[model samples]
Target: MGIRHIDVRLCNGCNICVEDCPLDVLRLDEATKKAYIAYLRDCQSCFLCQSECPQDAIRCVAVHERRMPKAW
Candidate 1:
């Protein structure tokens, strides 16, 4: 229900998603140079990776289903 998909075919390997993930959930594959969900369980579902992805290759569950942290 967290990160649902990563379309490697459409990914440009820009590393935006990897760098923007606050939880370090995504990683850049050294071989394919594509981003992958390295720690799906650690994902907070904040949608940061999806929004920052230039290629729009990342897809996560709807915002309503996310457990976003309360901003203090």
Candidate 2:
């Protein structure tokens, strides 16, 4: 399960979410120029990425909820 789901359509490749991640669980993809989950298990569930994202492209689901099949 991923820590956060980045909406590629809403993301502008600004890298704000990556910069705000305390655990460095998010990073920007050079090829896609979009944010992606780099280390989902390392996430601290702080919601910093979602809060800092200007485009609101990040969605961090609760750890308990991650076990469920989500539709994104």
Candidate 3:
């Protein structure tokens, strides 16, 4: 699965995901102080960010079915 969405409501501006993302697919918004997808295509979908997030804000979708739609 690739990185899908981030629940901004659940995110508390914690940077764990940003700090742990090996692919650097996410970053913290300096203005909103929230995590947002940065380089989506670069996402490795390892779920390291989701698992490391303390607030469980990161969400991922299964890609096994048919690679994540390129349109996304």
* Candidate whose TM-score is highest: 3
At residue 55, candidate 3 shows an lDDT of 93
Give the per-residue lDDT digits (tens) of candidate 2, residues 1-72. 335588999999998888877778888899989998878877778887887889988887767423555699
Off by over 4 Å in 2: 64-72
lDDT of 2: 0.80
lDDT of 3 by residue, 14-65 (tens): 7999888888888899999999998888887788887888998888874642
Tell how far residue 21 is off in model 3, in angstroms: 0.4
Candidate no. 3 TM-score: 0.82
- Number of colliding residue pairs in each model: 0, 0, 0
Which residue window of length 10 is worst by lDDT in model 3?
Answer: 62-71
Which candidate, 1 or 2, has the higher lDDT?
1
Q: How well does candidate 2 match the true structure in TM-score terms? A: 0.79
Segments of candidate 3 deviating more than 4 angstroms: 64-72
